[model samples]
Target: MKFDKAAGENTLFDNAEFVGRPTHRIDGPLKVTGTAPYAYERHDVVEGQLYGYPLGSAISHGLIVSMDAEAARNAPGVRAVVTTLEIDPLEKGMNNVARLFGGAEVQHYHQAIAVVVADSFEQARAAASLIEVEYEKGDPADYDLGAAFERLQGSGEMDTDTGDVEAAFSSAAALLDEMYHTPSQSHMAMEPHASIVDWSDGDQMTVWTSNQMINWNHGSLATTFGLDEDKIRVESPYIGGGFGGKLWLRADAVLAALGSRAAGAPVKLALPRPFIMNNTTHRSETVQRIRLAAGEDGKLTGIWHEAASHALPDGRGEDATAQTPFFYASDSIRAKHHIVTMSLPESADMRAPGEAAGLMALEVAMDEMAEKLGMDPVEFRKVNDTQVNPSNPEQEFSDRNFVECLDRGAEAFRWTDRNTAPGATRDGQWLVGHGVAGAYRGALVLPSGSRALLEGGKLVIETDMTDIGTGSYTILAQTAAETMGLTLDDVEMRMGNSAYPVSSGSGGQFGAASSSAGVYAACMALRERIAEQLGVEEAEFRDGRVIAGDTDRALSELEGQIDAVDSIEWGDFQSEYQMATFGAHFVEVGVHAGTGETRVRRMLAVCDSGRILNPITARSQVIGGMTMAVGAALSEDMALDSGRGMFANHDLAGYEVAVHADIPEQEVIFIDTLDPVASPLKAKGVGELGVCGVAAAVANAVYNATGVRVREYPVTLDKLIGGLPAIG
Candidate 1:
């Protein structure tokens, strides 16, 4: 079935019994009981497996003068020491700029320069320190943001100019011009980057690694080795967490394969916590300027968002202004992005990528403009809302309920009762205030495939989709059970194996909707096969039985089993209409009068992202995103040591993420609506939308409580104390 237009009546999910119901995760028991197998823990995968520890480059940017491994290779249990100098320089992966294994040039600090293989992890780690490397450290390239900003070059990708932005803003009734800065952030996933690799007879190689996209990793490995994809098998049956950090092929996977071949035995490697930060990709820091021009009635006339970000000399900068064109209503708008070349590690996507950082600036500007206009922020947003795309007026949204989200969220949050005056509401030494912001994330789907089989009174589904602790196993199980008319226990799901058909993987919030739709198509085909086997033209299947005009028989009565495979053929829905997830975020924060420390007291989110597949998992995704956004607003920053051109605090103890104590109880509400244009499931993505505008709401609440507006991120006390009003 192809999705060409908006869904009308008689859709497959119109009366879904199991799709919308709340359900517990199917893999929860295995994870909590410590029976689940992670990549590094797969001891049974290969026989006589060895351990490999990586040696990192000491210099941030320079060439390796020499590497001596004689002492390490002759150590107690060391089998092999593979240096970058031993093999030819391999091509980097398509999504990466730094070469993985054999390269003379050091791109950044902690880059894998060599791997020491031994019988045990302890021996490998001890022998790794025996190898010594001398580096010719040149004056490291510019590491200052201010200097990089001065050398910005035009990035032609996300630039847009519609009307005269400067003239319109100059003649507006009210104007807001502000510059916001967001620091680089790291993905603090619990599991480190790990891989286990082994080689078969001559050419066949298998890798058990933690990655988001199986097919992409397979292709990249083939490209690097100059071999056909059939020779490589990538399997990641379970992943602890990705958050876009494991989206592409990393050094651990590549080096493990190389180390195994060099040692003539299977090898396993896991990146240490410090190496994961400075060696792998990170979200680029952004410096953004937002200029909003509005009329006296709180309607927007124009919006101009320009952002500058840094990357490697050959890397693409983060397009931070991509969301401004279609977010709100405006006649004249200009959004531009600039790239500054640096010698830092290559930057890539984080949770929400551009919108996560962009909204932190855009939404706060909206609140500041509302304050100047003396209007409520929610009212201001409602006044400027548009049903159609502001960039292209001919295109209409397939399904948008932003107004409903804001209205329902405000009512539930009791937003009107909040104090209007700054520093008015107080409890003991804390001043309290409430704030709201609009959320938006563009919805998208990639073509995906799956296979289903029914045999021996059980339904089995197979795909390459990954869970990433997002509950993919439970939701996919729900889809198969609902379509096959079977109990939840009667179906099984197999995923994260490259032998299965290719899927959308687990990034961009598209995995659940797209992969489940593919499963639906495959299940439909299996149903047809069952009908053909029963010698009936058509039949209604339910409760493990089939009925066709009084010829009722149990589905298991068939002589043989059936299997089918199919793909979801998505049409040009993206070209004909606009698709996005919309939500409203309300945050209540309290600021200490004496210390100016801020703490979020409560939070609420109302979302409209088409039909929700599972309420329980969807709520979990939203609250997790909200918690990450709190860290972004309050304390998460990858501090850089400018003198050394390296991340100063490059471990979990230094980089702060929101803990349980940092976030309060969060309430999530999903609007009941479906968009047929999205997919057969009529569901859109809600994972990234939960983080888009949440930080700005926290910042807005902080300002309302203390009357101190912080343009920089993390809203720290030093930036607030000077501006705070004196207390009696």
Candidate 2:
């Protein structure tokens, strides 16, 4: 089923029994009861499984001089040892910027160099520590983005340009130019990158891993291992957490496979917490410059956004200017991005990716521009809202309610009650103020496939879609149940297996929309098959019965089980419509007058991202994003040891995330609407949109509380203490 035309009055729209309802997670019981088998805990699947521990390179960049694994091979209970020096560099995965294993040359710190296999995890870890390695360090790596930006200023690529931005800025009534910095961030998922691989079969291998994309990893493993795609089977039914860190095949999976092949037994490997920061992918730090020019009426005339971020030579940089071109109405708009090769670590997607860091600078600049114009921040954003893409005026937004989000959010947050004068409203030693920022994230969809089986009066749906704690199982069940006119209790969903039909695989916030559409398509196929079996041209499924004119037959009365397989492919609808999610973030904070400490009192996010599939799950995603935003605003920062080209604070103790005490009240409001151009499900993505502008809103609130505008991220107290108002 190709979604070529705009969806109109479909079953999901007219007779939705579960699609748009607030359904609880179908897999909640398994998770809460600790019965769900995570990758590292699935010890009952295979017998005689050995443990594997990986050894990482000490230097960030260098060529391996010598490696002696003799000590490790002779260590207690050691079964097999595989070192990078013995094998040539393996092929890199499609989604991986840095090589997972092999090769003598190190691309970054903590690059996997060897694997030690033993009878137990402790034995494997002990054996891995005995391996000796020598390296000839290369020239000092380029780890400073500021210096790289200075060298590549004139060579930067201009991604987008509209009218003359310079001339418009020169004549604008209000102009604001500033720079902001966001530090590199770790995913810090609850479960580490873990995998268990079994290669006992002659040429067939099976891997149970905590990966987000099953199809991608399956293909990657086949390519990297020089085996046929059909020979590999990847299963990841439950993932503890993955903020884009487990999107690709990491070293844990690769090492486990290699260890299993060498030891002639199934091998399990789990990366340490420190290795997770440097070995796996992380959100790249960005240096962004935003220049906004507006008229006296609070209408934006020119908007220029340029950013510099570091990545591996073969990797793409953080595109911090992704949303600038289409976010607001501007006659003159320009966006430029510069990528600098660095040897620190692999920089890749995390949550909202580009917009998460970009909006931290752009939205804060919006607040500064509003201040220059003496206009309210929410009002300023409302006046510049555009129904069409600013970069391409021919394309109009499918469904955008940015102004409504702003108005509704401002009203709910009591924006009018905010202290207009900075540092004037004091509650004891704390100064209170409010802040607002607009959110934007593109709604993306991918071709996804699913299989449906109707057996013993129960509907079963199968896809490779991963849950990642985002309620993929629940929402997918809801989609199939609604399409088949069955209750949620009568539907069973099986996912995260490569044998299942390929799906969108839960990234870029497109998982729920695309995967659910695929299930819907498969259900439709089943409906057609049921109609054909009943000798009818068409049939309506209701109350678990197929109705054809005057004849009605219960699905349970069918002679045998019926099955259907189908996929949802997209056409040129995206070209005709600008599908994007929009929202507004409002925050209230109190700043300590003497110590410059800040604490958030409350936060509200008003989102306009098409139809909500499951309100319960949708709220969980939004609040999770909000909690991350608090960390990005106040605590989360992966301290880089630039001199040594490594992340100094690689462990969780050094790198802080938001805790219960750090988070205050959070509210999420979804604007009720359907996006026909987005998908057959009439839904867009809200996960990324929930995070886009939240950090900026927190920064703006802090600035309002204490007239000290923080240009750098993680707005720590040290940066604000010096500029804060003098103690009373």
Per-candidate TM-scores read 0.97, 0.99
After superposing candidate 2 on the true structure, give the runs of residues whose Cα lies further than 4 Å from its correct spot.
725-728
Instruction: Write model 2 residue lDDT over 18-89, tens digit each, in one string.
Output: 888999998999999999999999989898989999999899998999999999999999999999998988
lDDT by residue (216-243, candidate 1, tens digit) is: 8989998887778999999998899888
- Give the lDDT of residue 66 in candidate 2: 92
Q: Which 10-residue span in candidate 1 carries the lowest summed lDDT? A: 149-158
RMSD from true fold, candidate 2: 1.1
Scored by TM-score, the top model is: 2
Candidate 1 deviant stretches above 4 angstroms: 150-158
Model 1: which residue pairs collide? none
lDDT of 2 at 103: 76
List of clashing residue pairs for candidate 2: none
